[model samples]
Target: MPAIILDDISFSYSSSPLLDHVSLRVGDGERACLIGPNGCGKTTLLRIVTGRLLPDRGTVTCAGDAGPRLIPDTEGSGGSVGEYLDASLRPLRVLFTRFEEITARISEGGGDRLAREYDRLLAQMTARDVWSLDARVDETLAGLGLSELTGPGRGRSLGSLSPGQRGRLRLAATLLVRPETLILDEPTNHLDAGAVGFLARTVNHWHGPVLMASHDRAFIEDTATVTYDMDIDVWRALARAEGADEFTGLHRCAGNYSDYLEEKRRARARHSELHAAQQAEKRGLREHRQAGARIARGGVRLARAEGMAKKYFADRAAATATRRTRNDDRRLEDLSRQEVRKPRGYELSFPMNPVPVRPGSALSARRVAVRRRLASTSFDLARGEHLLVTGSNGAGKTTLLSWIATGKPPAGAQASGTIASDRPIGFVPQHLPRAGDPGFAEEIWLRGIGELGRGILHPSMWTVPVPELSAGNQRRAQLAMALAGRPPVLVIDEPTNYLDLDTMEALEEALHRWTGTLVVASHDRWLIDHWHGRGLHLEPA
Candidate 1:
């Protein structure tokens, strides 16, 4: 049975229609992904289906015997596990409280005997296995990697945990309830790659239906049996083939993302060719009347036949000559321009000194150790060099970047050292702050840049709010802000997170032109391969 269904759903925020009569259904145990460019309504659609936001028009229905039930959000509730569990099982809590009251009344006695009566009450509670509640809470906590949350007196607040940890805890609480349907929105955002993989595995093993909206391509590819690409194409063809509203099959490409792109290019080329052919036939039909008119006029008068024929032939010859001349002109122009100036790829390298003495190191680290959730490790970075830091999820790459930026020495530094240059430094963090009050954020960022007095700032940058800017533009703005400090060194973390291919390439070109020292932490293989720099490999200890 379908887990959830949307029939002719239409949603509009303000005057703009985000979804246009969209309809889709997810089946039991089906894993699906919703993908699209930013601002493409993926999140809005997810919210609508998850019942967080209501649709402007149309009906959303759920199948199976049980209908929709609200699942409580477990984060930042300032409630203990027991409290949450009790809230979830409110009817059971009420029944248990009634039983306790009845038992207390039955044990009513007098004097010192009342003390023994209290002990007897405690023994009765133990016999009734009331302590099992704590054990159950501990089990849930341990499963969610919150083993420290064990014990009734260990007053560990959920607020003390990081957002990622809280997110995990929320998922754990929901899973413990064993809901029939699950809807996750950008659940992987706060999770490391390892946690993402674990989530994918969990989804695959789940008996209930799963519907998720995510930007993480790997997670989608691993988990989704159906994918809805909003603002591009819906999977109606797959649904039709499956003989159901829900697609039961996964989209399997014979090769990688590049291969899929190549297939799309071929399909688009065929479509264009067919369109061009149809246009040519239409043009030929439109020109047919002129040719027939000339022929008819020539045939009507014999005296003018020879002259008309000559004129017709001359017209044809002139047209042919004109075509040839235009073709020749175009060919010559193409050849000339082809040889004129090809777009040169940027060449990035450290500035060379005339004397050519051994280039002094920009920064250096010796026997540096890093501590992360997954493991502990150490490494070194040399000056006048670029190093790619590569690792799997939970390998502490982000932590390392933070350590470098803060200038806090790494853990277990047997022979740790940091060499500083007179030049200033710039650091672009992985996550750009969300656009709230764009005017205020932009002004603050620009003022910081102005203080460095190192580079020219563009004036057009002020027009659009920071939130309105594209991801690539946001990263560029952050980079500009960092460079504004005129730091001799720059460290950028995950610079290509939301960037498209073209923007990613453009960023690489810009980075190549930069004269300052750079340290980049990224997972993009293309960025690593195109980078003309050394690499610092970190592994789990």
Candidate 2:
């Protein structure tokens, strides 16, 4: 029997069906990935398989010695770690109840004292390891980089951790349970490069079956042994063979994502050509048949025949109109092809104003320290210059950006610095704010573009909402907002987090055109190599 199986599962939210009679089976120890565009029912299907949700039709079956274990949606269940664990172990409560019942029966007999002693012993046995629970919790926390997750020294609550950290914690919890099967949804959502790397390794080493849903192409390449493509028509199993490159494999005929996209374009082109030929042939046949019929009835000279001819002509015109409509549809389909580009970071620039030569320096830092490391650091950023800041995880890259923005150093650090610029400074941080903020999407974006003027806000901008905007558009909005002040310097941190290739190219072009000082912190190798900037490497202590 398969470890997990979905038999003719169908689900609908509202009038639209999300999963249309989809069926799939995953074998024990198999690692499969579910991939599709957003709102494609990947998450919904996962929920159904885990028993957290019931499908409108059909059933999900799990055949294993350990049975099924479902992980609830974090947002739906407001339960803490302890609460979740308790719920998971609820079956154990029945055994304890049975023990209590036995004790109750013994106490009713003549040997009341012995029954009381047995009751005491039973209670002690059941709770023998209760005191050590805290220790176990602490160990799990430490493994997830939450060493301070115990006692008064617990400086940060679980909620305070970054999304990446929270994801790690979830993984740790699952590992503790040692379940036979694991289902993950968008597991790489908030992870940085290093964290993603760590997770890739973890998944590769996992012994049990895994079914993950994600939009991150890179993560899917690294982790998925088999790929499942869910479409409106059917669920497909992509071919997987030896020596396959995750980015470009047999599941897809072309190669990587870009290659697959090109293939789609070619297919669309062929479809259009065939459709146009078919329409032309049908039109010709219809016209020929109409002319033949008119010739066959030519001898009729009555007024009724004239009227019938007019009606036949009208019907023929309507047939021609239908053919034209089909042709128009084919043409529209050809023109509507969407091109997929590779992921790339964005380029940002600030509006410039000529600044007089400063007597001292553009920027100076003296005796700077961050995170109990990078002791007594000092650096200067000159005008019209570019600098790259490099560091590992938790090396204070974000802390430095915060300090620059707020004019306050990180905890246990002090710095004296001066920033002089002729243009307004623009800064793009690593993480963007949540999309739930108020404003029509376009307005929020226009606001981000800042005071760069109405020219930057194109007429098409109004059509898209801010939260629904792509990563590149969001970065553009942030850039526009920063440039609104017209600062002379631009400070960017990890600017290319979720950008695609085209947007990154646009950013590079925009930056090349801008005449302002640039200060950036990034880990993108391509961006670092191509960008016309100096490097500032931050090594771990």
Candidate 3:
């Protein structure tokens, strides 16, 4: 039986529809991944599933105790750590109160309806194991690396926690709450390598259905049992048609991301073949009809010159032409009903051109430490060398990178260090600030790298504001703009955070080919596994 279902879900933000008659289902113990390019309505669909947003049409159903619980992209507002934990369990608290009420009503001589309600509530409680909720909470906290946040740390304000800590807290609370269906939107966004591995394990072993929207290819490949891809443009066109079916884009594939790619490739090839064949058939029919018309015209001219004997030949030729044309028209009508639409393809091209540098040590950091954030660290990077920083979340990778790239630590971070760099360095921080005066893409153009920027971004996006771009597109623009003036050194923090697989591959290739001194802090397993550079591993301070 399906644990979650969305039937005929149609939605629109403006005059144009984003999601139209989209239907999806996940059975008990199944894991489904929703993947698409940036701004393709993935977040919108996930919000609809979690009931955070309602669709213009369609119904959402979740089997079992409670509705789906979402691990959101952003954290909640002001609240103590303990208070947040308590609020997460409110659904369980409500169920417990209802159970008591139903029991009391039965004792007061209730009917069959009351007994059935009591039984249903009892099953829900049993499934959640409410008797051991406290112990489960402790286990969940520890598993997600939040054991310290409990006990003496529970009193800590949410504002005090780092962005990574806040993100993990949301994930832990959702896991401990144990809703009937679990839904996650970019769940691995703020996670480190170890934390993402833990998430994959927990999700793989989950008892209920799991539906997630993520650009983390490594995590999706590890945890997803089914892949739901909505990246195709044809699906949207079909959904907008007058008599479209409920499942406009039921492009569900079994297995992981790799399998989905292979299946989609084969399907696209078949669609192309069918379309090519239909075009050939139509062309042949048109040529044959024209040839018949030519024959009829010649026979008419011959008959007029010869008399009654050749008139019969002309009549016969005309009849044959009419029959041939009629047959071709019927064939064309049949082919129209089985027309095959072309598939959509996505591509990214990023070329980095680094400025020339003298051969020597490009940067050196001696005993660098940020107050309460980073421990003392020392490293030297040669000109044109590549260095990768590896660490768990909150282990100060971002803090260290900010110092190296900007010649200073992040705001409010007091640093004690000796960091020296002779050449200019281009930096793309984890969280980019707003672009003042010129738009983000426009900045790249002003730096005389408009051609390079065009490889990563569409020309139209050059005039758009930075805040209006999708996260993935924004990341692309950031990288393209960073290469402005061809800095001798480049520093990037979590470069793979919001990028789709294709764009990620393009960025990886560009990094490998670029002849620049590089420093990157990333938690992407796929990127890490493929890296062949020096590594700086950090432990939590």
**Top candidate when judged by lDDT against the true structure:** 3
Is 2 or 3 the stronger prediction by TM-score?
A: 3
Candidate 1: misplaced stretches above 4 Å?
A: 64-68, 89-140, 152-162, 233-364, 368-386, 390-415, 419-427, 431-462, 465-473, 479-490, 496-518, 522-541
**Candidates 1 and 3 compared by lDDT, better number:** 3
**Of the candidates numbered 2 and 3, which has the greater lDDT value?**
3
Question: Candidate 1 lDDT, tens digit per residue, 10-32?
Answer: 88887977887777778887776
Give the TM-scores of the predictions, in the order they appear: 0.58, 0.53, 0.72
| Model 2 agreement with the true structure over 1-541: per-residue lDDT tens digits | 3387877788988888778767777777676787554556888888887777899998887664222363332333444545554454334444355566767777676376667667665654343223344465566556555455444434444455556655655664554444557777776665556556666676776566777776565666667767665531110111111112222201222133334335444544554454465456556655765564454443343224467776675566556656655665565454333212221222344455555434434455565556445434567877666677777766666666656654567656644443233333466667774443222244554343333423343335534555656655666666665566666677778776655443554566676666666677876645666678677776654
Measured on C-alpha atoms, candidate 3 has an lDDT of: 0.77
Clashing pairs in 3: none
Off by over 4 Å in 3: 67-84, 87-122, 152-170, 192-198, 234-247, 265-345, 352-386, 394-396, 399-425, 436-452, 465-467, 484-489, 512-518, 532-534
* Models, CA RMSD each: 12.4, 11.7, 6.1
Q: Rank all candidate structures by their lDDT, best first, as comma-separated numbers.
A: 3, 1, 2
lDDT per residue as tens, model 3, 251-356: 6889997887787667666656766777898899889888978877755466466678577777777888888889988988877666555544444554444347
